[model samples]
Target: MGDQSDKGQHPANSPTPYAPYAPYRRPGRRPYSVRMTTGGSGIAHGFPHLDTVRAALAALFRRLSHDTVSTFPTSVLPVDVAFDDTEDVHLGAQRIARAVVHQLHLPDARIVITFREMEHAATVELTAGPEYFVELNDRFRRHRKDIGAALAHEVTHVWLHRLDLSFPGTRDNEILTDTAAAYLGAGWLLLDAYREHGPFSQKLGYLTPEEFGYVLAKRADFFDEDPAPWFTSPQAYDAYTAGRARARQDARRPPLAGAGWAARLRYAKDRRAAQDPRRTAGPVAGPGDGYAFEPAAGTGAPLRVSFPCPTCWQRIRVPVRGHLQARCGLCKTLLDCDT
Candidate 1:
């Protein structure tokens, strides 16, 4: 086949041009299908077993961002590529979905993109079969800036469905999914889609643009990547800056590295209590089970704080400034210390 310049104008029923780019697949494997429903609170109420989820996502994104570096597009997509026809929208969505799935190493799975004139922005049909179907609200055809983020969010549903992961209930699964999309890399596109000017604005995704920015900023911080230049929307850039500030504020809390399971349980409780309104007293600074604060010397020295590692119960101390690296002397466990 010859190289086609306008890939989007290809025949409607033909296979996506991206099919040849699939990088991962096992021979003689039959595709399995799983059905999942779409309807729940988009608000983030946190998720159960969050620590484990975060740990898994951290490892997955570390590999995906490094190995599948080209999964994301190289150039910034125009935020105003409007479409008047649903077929054109579907074609564009297909191209974006192909790029995302190929990057995630899912060479065998095929996703069918369709559209419906609906109130909700978009949804993915999680069926108990191999074929994946994503339906976008036809309204989005006019709001082209959201195409990438919406497709990324739905495509993430397919990936998570294939992994057979689910939260305890429906109330927070959407938030978890949103977090996965952002933390896993697609969330950057969502943040970049955020647009607001006076009365006209468009924000698309399971989570609010601010929440998306928060997760993206957190991931960028983890990967040591600068996300400022990637942002096209001024509103998104502002949200990202604010989210980074929040992450830094939360970083002031003590390290939960060396505590035992029981102690870690108590630490979670204490951490929540510290945020309770009735608890007006600040975090007690002492050399006890909880975090301890060390007074600075003279006038210019920075105050240092210490916390027990969740792994080996060793107290690690560092200046109360920005995030720093720490190594437990007893267990020799390396840690990323923010407190």
Candidate 2:
């Protein structure tokens, strides 16, 4: 990693050797089984970064603690980043940069904003100082509206760096950054930055548009906030809808009280398997199942089931008694379970 490296290739996720949509894998990271690489589609849609995104959410609660995570109850306001085309480029960029810093709660951090011709959307130096230098792609000089989106991402890098939280590799780590940006209230710009039409497309941040929506949806659910009215791009709203639907499904997984009949039926069968004397109970017995069963802790103790907390994806274990509310120790999200 060098200062020249734009947060995993250039921040602009176009298909290229240095771009995100390209089939570029870091040296030691394992390749995705799916063809998540860039193609004629331009922007890769769906939940390609899903696993990493979930892990990122868990990492957020783990590092920042639930109380700190709850403090970001509101997303960045549209007024905070508004830029008039007639506004001075340097001054306006600095203003937007400061807005991002303030919204992200980097009270002591000072950002030096500059623009130059570059392949990435933006880059920020992760330094120990109270001052950070951010270089924006020269294109942003003309496309001022997205300056907020770029700074939202780069400033979040500073926030995460300060928290000293990161994932293993470049790709997952970038996903963590993206997830933190969205869930912590500054990332809606990333989703709003997505615009695709007539073979031309632009997307900011590492998470796919849907993934951005998913994290946003998760944030909204926790804070009881709605971001639908903030999106100027219909495509972004639609992607949010799709991602929100997916996020809502997390609560409907088997063992959760809200689960549908089919899932509940499956859970019943799995429960039977766990109780069967011949079957060995373990953390997992099937693929695509969000839960597993473990043997009872003591001779008379009840059999226990383990499932992921819909909020942070942290695995939660509870006794196999019916109608219990489990609160995730990590994110502190309370859930209604029927195990």
Candidate 3:
């Protein structure tokens, strides 16, 4: 009787799968929701089309060919392209590097591109691979064109860095990189690509589709053509439509006064003076002074003070100065003084 048998007894306590274990609470002030949602500190919207992108690059290439001065060193860089076996993002970065290498004519610098499956989602990082190495994002694999464009853009940054052209804190440095790309004959393509995938959003400090268009437009103006037609994308279309409308409106609006009006009046006066010598000679001293004035001509006698309306043929007085508003006696239509 010292110990009771409990082999057949059911245990009073049990654990349920659905039992709440205080929910997985995040530590340290919830780590800020906005910070968590914003994936990276880069802009991430508005991408452009492929053809426009190519055209822009081709244009840049052509320009670089024509430039007498060279911003890049005489020696060229070597570039190696490869994809990450484990991650899909590496494909895009690899493709972009290849495109850049293909387009560039460097001869001395060695560049190795490798794809690595890293913890980060997708990014392009520059490193010293004995020469230079870049790690590309996996997402780029699906968007080949964007990859090429983005890689070209970053490569440009590298070029600037090597040249000691980059300045800290000033937007001018970024602009210089962009300008250098264009000047060397790839600006339009880069701009097109930028428009296609460039960052945009007031809240995010990214370039908007419109801003991309505007930049492309400026680039086009620099080259003297409509960049819109070169590359066709939703962003390009919207920009072109808006730009065309603005141009038309601008054309219709009267120019500022002064020189424009003076020119117009001068032309008008010259034509009138050529047609009537007497009018230009001098005003008559008096209506009937000794000056032998020609008879009131044109209709044999002076035009009748009142005459038949041309439309209804009713007698009507064409007012002196021909500046009075009147109604047709027969047609009852309002008539302008000049008419």
Q: Which predicted model would earn the best TM-score?
A: 2
List residue ranges in candidate 2 displaced over 4 A.
1-40, 280-286
Who is ahead in lDDT, 2 or 3? 2
Candidate 3 lDDT over residue span 1-339, tens digit each: 111221122224521111111112223321101000123334333433322332333333333442422333221111223233353333334344545544443323444333333342222233322243443333333434444444555565565554444434434344444444443434344434433344431111123334444444433433444555544355446654553443232112111111235443443343344335356343222111111122234434432123223222233454223235566544443544321
**RMSD vs true structure, all candidates:** 11.4, 8.6, 25.5
Best by lDDT: 2
Could you give candidate 1's per-residue lDDT for residues 1-339 as a string of tens digits?
222322354466767532321122334543221112233323232223334434434434444443443344332233322333444555667767776565444554566765555565666666654655666665555666567767666777677776676555553556556676676666677766666666566666555555666666666655566677878789788878876664443344445343345554554555455445465554535334558655554467775667754333345677666467887555444777544
State the lDDT of candidate 2 residue by residue for 80-174, as single tens digits: 89998777666677677787787778874444666665567877777665875677776776778989988888888888887788788878878
Angstrom error of the Cα, residue 125, model 2: value is 1.2
Clashes of each: 13, 0, 25
